[model samples]
Target: MNQLKKPVIVAFTIITCLFSFSSCKKDSNNNSVDTDDPASADPTLTLVWSDEFNGSTIDTTKWNFEVNGDGGGNGEAQYYTARSTNAAIKDGKLVITARKENYSGKSYTSARLTTQNKAAYTYGRVEARIQLPTGRGMWPAFWMLSAKTPLEWPHDGEIDIMEAVGYRPDTTFSNIHCTAVGYGDLLPVPDYGRTYHVYATDWTADSLKFYVDDRLIVSYANAHLADATAAYNQWPFNHNFFMILNVAVGGAWGGINGIDDTIFPQAMSVDWVRVYQRK
Candidate 1:
């Protein structure tokens, strides 16, 4: 009887020690959740495409320069050029500079880069980390347009993930343009123009959600635009769309106040552009 009792006691002690160790490890792991990285927190997102701008030169295969001084139909002051002076890559960043100079019948020069026919996506998450420029006339935008061959402005649809007028340094705009403009709430962040921020849009069949640093700032649901016919004019986002990045000087909205010559040579730098989809 004594031998049996000793063996039983030893087994019970070993089991207790194992349980305590496992519980402590579990508690420690639970308390150490990382919150700084958005990807780690979001388990469903899978990276589909990305341009880190890691090289010293822009990848021609991914982006094409829209070489024109058409003012982008906004009566903008800058002449969009394909020169490296207006757009260049350095230190893993794509810089779009708006310079004050006489060029091609325009008073200023800038660059407009697009992934129009080169690349397009139906729906997913698209985002960019950008540092904006400042001045009275500076207009920087990160947006998307429909890939329709015969594109009609404000009719095919436009998704503005981010837009900022130089005069308003602390405000950011996100909007959708179709038959009518559907604007999002103005986001006021501290030192917005001077600091880098992540602007993103999660697009799906039913809704489009805009985010800043993974925080949802605005959302537009198809239900709001739903009508009897469900025409393409109202819900044109169902088709594939491409991305565009540009810095316009003194446009219809950006130049509402006026152009500031002192802010010439202003630049908007993009750290990276990423696309993702649900796993």
Candidate 2:
């Protein structure tokens, strides 16, 4: 979540609040019921935007290729490139390949794609079906960051819908990073590298829920808002955020356990990415 270093500590403080009887509406039986409860009336979801990767080439209008060799502030070994070899659409899937080679003074080459200025959303349900690559040093992630100008890391906020380090091929992580706190949750997907899974997050003003294959794994609420000391740093999800998909090579968490050079060519194949909003 730190972007520079994955936090080693997993500390989460969950605060629960009781529903106020005064806010409840009376039912036919004179029973108090919260009509505004999300469970009582779930909104219908409408597909607002999506990319099935059915085209022959990457859709430049929707995605931007980020080319950099800055290590992503985490000592990553790969240089992100815009070349087709690093990122391309094939067989109805978006393939992001990481290759071990001598390129631009780096030992690895990978791709990073984002929907920054081209598209951004405030709150909704975002999901992606992806098949990950395995072997140590590989780090694949589908995440989001604030789209606000003059980007601020950890301050503007970050949401990691799915992150898998090759060392732990069976486990995937979801996390939220803000100035107030950074917490993460993990889910085990057997044979993750060989299978495809839907990683998603339902974000609203009240909470953020993460899921794998539609199974809920993590639920983070805006509990800090009730505290008098809380500020924008505690909850910065009110603004627009852009999505990012990438496979980072050996940096921080992914590189903690040394990389296995034998696995030279690894790739993350994305089947589709869809965004839905309550209609």
Candidate 3:
């Protein structure tokens, strides 16, 4: 998710480049990198953190529920709440539900969970298994944002590992936002609303790779890393970033076709979240 606004709908174009294996380089590298290659499982990576969602309740020690009705800066219709009815652990999965209700001056209610102050990472492999919600109004996402206080969006950077709007049930989007530029791509993902699939991102100082069911879909290499005139706005992903999971309703992108009020009580079920770092 882009912080200030939803991503611009444009032709899907993957910004790709090559970098040295020894250091982060710019697009000038001579080696031709294939962005479509499946990122191989690294044996050196060890699972350093994980949430199996096996508990009876949301683990407050690792997550914080954001309560607000600020429209998520996207003209969203749902009011985020911290109630168990909005988010709960059931059947070994963290279920985030969006329901039709008049609450806090909003016509819909939902949940937004974050690992803001609880857990953050600089660079690693983060992944989650989730079964999404269907219908015309649902907007479910697994994303990350800078952990810096007094957040400054776009400049601080955002990584949208997975985003699926209810109307586009067979397509999922992956994007990265920065002050320099924002790039996104769409991929075909069948039965995403009814079946579980793994959404993952491998992040490093040099690049970001997005995967669905272990198949690489989008790969972005840092374009300003080796440039002498580059500024922080070109790449602000070096610092710590925390995770966010939410189900938004009638947002800028999700509400483009208007919402289907009949599909209330939609839920996004997250089976597990795991983070890995090189050991």
Candidate 4:
């Protein structure tokens, strides 16, 4: 009787151990987020500047819209509009929407907002919490261009903090463009449309660090920033740059998707945009 009782006790103990191990394994996949409200998120960054977009309308005082005629960007077929139809503030967020409607000869419509005359920064961490738009022919971006460019693009340079095309919803890219290097795009992830992620850049005298959701992706050092090599033209980023936000439809880069009229008024929603200077 004693031996039989001992075997039963061992069997029970083994079963309990297996159950606990299974529970731990299940918890590893439950990537739970905090229960805190977005508005209540702690400010861990130094607020050097921002466009909260809190007003009833786009605070034109801090931003201006670009209205590109039908042949925008040199024959690109997008009639960029500044109207509220293209961009608006609703429920405490900035929405840049694009549609496949004909206002005139142009077949597609969208918005492009800029801070060229409003804000300029030489070195700082620029961040935006954004979610991408879905469907082909949709192109959304957060970027910067030379604030004081007398000539044209490529000469002044371009910095793409984040750019995504609906056709390639799986990937978002960050790239630097100059006359010498031409242009380069990289794959940061496979699927960006599934969730809201933080797209950010920390630019300093030393280098620029690219991050997504506090996770570091790549760091370009000052040497690379100042590199005079023909492949990496340094003139573009050495000067000040202003910010731009937009959602383009059926353009050179976006038009590759043909057109999806069914997904009219697709929005690139931005939760927040913040800039921080070093302490």
lDDT per prediction?
0.76, 0.81, 0.82, 0.65
Q: Which residue pairs collide in model 2, if any?
A: none
Per-residue lDDT of candidate 3, residues 122-178 (tens digit): 998988878899999888999999999988988888999999888887889888888
Clashing pairs in 3: none
Model 4: per-residue Cα lDDT at residue 211: 69
Model 4: CA > 4 A from native = 1-45, 70-75, 182-191, 224-232
Candidate 2, residues 13-103, lDDT tens digits: the string is 0112245732232222332222322221334765567777877999999999989998878888899999999999988789999999989
RMSD of each: 18.6, 11.1, 9.9, 17.1
- Kindly indicate the candidate among 2 and 3 with the higher TM-score: 3
User: Which TM-score value belongs to model 2?
Assistant: 0.86
Cα distance off (Å), candidate 3, residue 237: 1.0
Q: Please count the clashing residue pairs in each candidate, in the order shown.
A: 0, 0, 0, 1
Best by lDDT: 3
TM-score of each model, paired residue for residue: 0.84, 0.86, 0.87, 0.76
* Candidate order, lDDT descending: 3, 2, 1, 4
lDDT of 2: 0.81
Positional deviation of 34 in candidate 3, in angstroms? 28
Better of 1 and 2 by TM-score: 2
Count of backbone collisions within predicted model 2: 0
